[model samples]
Target: MSTSPRGRLVVAAVLFPLILASCTIDPSTGPVAISSATSSGVSLPGATFPSGAPSPTTASSPTVDTSRTTGSSAPSSPTLPSTTAVPAPRIRTSPADGADGISPTAPVTVRAQAGTFLRVALTNPEGRPVTGAFSAGRTVWTSTEPLGYRRKYTLTAGAVRPGAPRTESTSSFTTLSPLQTIYPSFFPNPTMKTVGVGQPMVIIFDKAPVDRVAAEKALSVKTVPAVKGSWFWWDDRTVHYRPSTHWKPGTEVTVSANLYGVHLGGGSYGEADRSMSVTIGPSRIATIDDATKQMQVFVDGRKVKTFPVSMGMDKEVTVAGQKISFVTPSGTYVAQEKYEVKQMSSASYGLPVNSSLGYDSRIPLAMRFSDGGIFVHAAPWSVADQGVRNVSHGCINLGPAAGRWFYDNFGHGDVMTVKGTSTRLDPSDGFGDWNISWDKWLAGSALA
Candidate 1:
């Protein structure tokens, strides 16, 4: 329409307000037209312009996400690593499979890792099962008894976890076969188990042990009420144990030589274990004085009887290139053995019967006190010299009645202390362990 300038200004002024209310400009998308009903619509830069737009009749199509436009793709979820199943626990056995030369004393054991034991067995060569016990929770098993020497043994064990199959394992081992085996013999044989307080625990090996310490280590002494004692190696084959003082009367003692499977040096091994138990009877001690030529007997520290005695004559004689002293060595001694009628012969000590000082006779009511053929016996021939003079070879001569009384009253382990002699008793002579001082006795112990 061609209108004058004044008319155009008037029209522009009237439409300016309406246009401003209908159209809005966006900085990024240029301009947007407003629908009268919905009041929202998007307009592209080059689209046809409209002063007003109608609202859609139905609910507007679900709002399209304008964040992503048409030529772009959606991102995929991150890939996850695959998972694996866990295995069940395994069973273990000791000694390892195919082991040989195992000690018979060593314990056989079975264990399970993070599982409970299902079954365990150890079988000997004879197809017999060895005794064993299971630990709490059934997780471990151990053999209860020692195995046999030079024998093969088999072990089998099984364990399982919840909802899993049982896992089993097997092992085989062989015990050592010793080249030489030595057996130990204990003193105070089983027949005469009761002994005096001075009696010591003695063990004599059939074969001399090269490693005395090893042999000593295997020996043990247990006394009721607990007595302090130590073992002394008397010789290669003999070891003796004594208390610091005389064993208390009525004490019970148990000795163990647990030497099985012990390597005792050289090619020797212990044959088997041995044990002995003995009870100490009433304390009976006899003291003899060479100067007084008298013997006093005591029971439990109380003097009970006194008798005349004739000790060795304190004479030395040369026989077979050896000087044989008739004087009995003085020291502490223990009654080792008793005999109703013991045969005495100087020839036993290298003196022949033809020699002037040699004599062979059967003596009655004899008790041996030393390994060197010394004894206290009934001597009818020397009865007159019993109290007044010292006569007879290395023996204490007692009247028949006195000897009988001693034989009837005294037994093994009874103490016999002798005084006034030039020579001292050797510790290895009979049960002469009391001759050693307490300090020296402890020094003899292997463990000490």
Candidate 2:
């Protein structure tokens, strides 16, 4: 307590060193300590220290920073390689594989899926290629021609897509076999060029069709100056078409039989199609009256000439168990043929040449009109009986002059009407198409 000022200054310098050694500064904590105790056993305000513990010094180990510690980071997931899948090409065919009994007219086709076609082929049993064409994009193929009946066909096709493998397909099929086939033939031969007004359109078949309705539906008739007409079946193999009346002069007629590929029933099919055309000529008609024993010829509704004629004598003879009539049957007939000289014989009608009513001789200027051996010809031996008495077989007896004139004037399909006779003319005797009524003719058609 009794020290001088100089002595106090020396003591102060010595204490300053000890004070600096006792304190330490931590960067993480605040700058001041609170309620710390000094070496004099006194408590200092706002300074903190643990009881019976020494204060921190600058030499203490530096605080380790645990927030940023590093040894090895977490391993990342391995990435999978990127990839894309492609579709393969596919080929399809019609009349599928191993097909049988296919129609010849059936359609044949090939198609590609997810691809374009590379090649396509169809071949017959004979190894010949069938004709076909591919679509614009080369994805489809179709057949162009009809196939043969009872034939086997093969198809081979290939297709491919971009960055994909090529694909191929094959198929085989067989066509149906018909039991029989029929062909049609047209008459008044196509070469005739022109025909009479009363001429009918006739069709004859090599083999009869069981399905008559099918055959009738396949036929068609067209006329320029249209006329109403109907078809009549004369028998199983014959059919005829005629107008309600005689065809008009100058009329053009065309007939068609569209029968190919048509089914005719009972396993039968049509072999081919046919057609014909003909022009109608001027009208020429001949009328005979048995009461007057005269024949009048008319052209276009005007009488041209007349001739006295003697018809068959009214008699009958029995030979070979057949009844032969001498009377000429009465009905309409057409001029079928002509000859300068034709041999007449009774043997053609089942009468023996040795019989009492039998005679064989060469006649002049003969014109046949009936299938029963009836004709209009010259009989100089019976000239006295002309237009006076009937004395001869079933023929119209005319004088030599009249016979030559008639033969020179008449031709095929010229109409001839005969009246006043006991027997009736059969519809089957010749071109008897006109004998049937219109209603009856229409009834004969299968479609009716």
Candidate 3:
């Protein structure tokens, strides 16, 4: 409807109250005025935007338009920086990881790099911790004693940088089994403070080893001032190490078996390393001449005494109630045993006692050389043939005074060499390595 300007003013004033009832006030701008010409139920161009919005030409306008987008809008918060810087820890080990046939005695060591160590632990399969200690500087750690055989061990190490997370590493390994192990029992017993100059170093095995060469290579001998020697195998179970000559009196000898990781074949391995030091006593040797029927005793290479002695009988003798022979086998021998009064019996030697060929007698001042009942003992009955002829059964028959002197002086390891006997002595007849030639003795060595 059209109205004159003057009449419209009067109508406009009356319609103002009614028009104001349908319009809303804008807080940013004062009020929104509505006119009948513009009231078409449609929004004005900039009316949809909130007040104080930037215009199209304003410098504060957003770079991208988001009005046509479907989702609600606010920019996402920027990603923040991490709180701490962490360093990765690294580990190195001895006997290296996954190594096989490791020695039980070898040390297990662990070292960590790039950070201070926090903790380290070594455990067996049962989770029982192995005892260990860190180095003075705290960079490396090692187990205190030998590890077990056929065992699985686990090692865990931890380290950390300042204000950073702890870093850790782990390794696992298995040790050699008992089936791969060999142990050597040494000679001279190591308990004897002093041994004879002629005492050979003996080593006996609990079980026979298949790879004798490998086993021999693991053994070594050292003297204080170094002496030449050779090792000889008596059998699969026994071995001897002897110097070219007797040990120099007062010299120290050290024998070592470094077989920790050595393979002894037949699924046997050396279990652990072993070593021993021994001292040699004075040199004493007795040389018996069967042809002359005399015995010469030497102390440190100086002939000290000569005694007339009648050795083993020319033939087996049977007298009284026993059958006995005085024939002593010819060889180098050690004093196997000694007794003041040893009862002699023919039955012990598989010979029957008969009135004419055998006799049982209790002998005095007896020093033995073999397990077969051969000895240097007093034989008063053969005193007439001491230095003239061999008339008694095999044995070094000495006069009463000479027998007492020899018996008192000679002990377990004294040396005696017998010459001119038809009966050859086996090397094992006694503890007599001197019976074997040096070349032949060396040939017995696996490492030769």
Pick by lDDT: which candidate is best? Answer: 1
Tens-digit lDDT track of model 2 for 215-279: 99889999999988988998999899998898888999999887765678898777766889999
Reference-based TM-score of each model = 0.78, 0.70, 0.72
Candidates 1 and 2, the one with greater TM-score: 1
lDDT, candidate 1, at 39:
9
lDDT of each: 0.73, 0.71, 0.67
Q: Residue 59 CA error for candidate 1 (Å)? A: 91
lDDT of 2 at 49: 17
Ranking by lDDT: 1, 2, 3
RMSD of each: 27.9, 34.4, 24.3
Residues 210-249 of candidate 3 have per-residue lDDT tens digits of 9998888888999877899999998897889998778888
Write model 1 residue lDDT over 188-290, tens digit each, in one string: 7766679999998889999998888888888888989799889988877888888899999989999998887788888677887888999999999999888
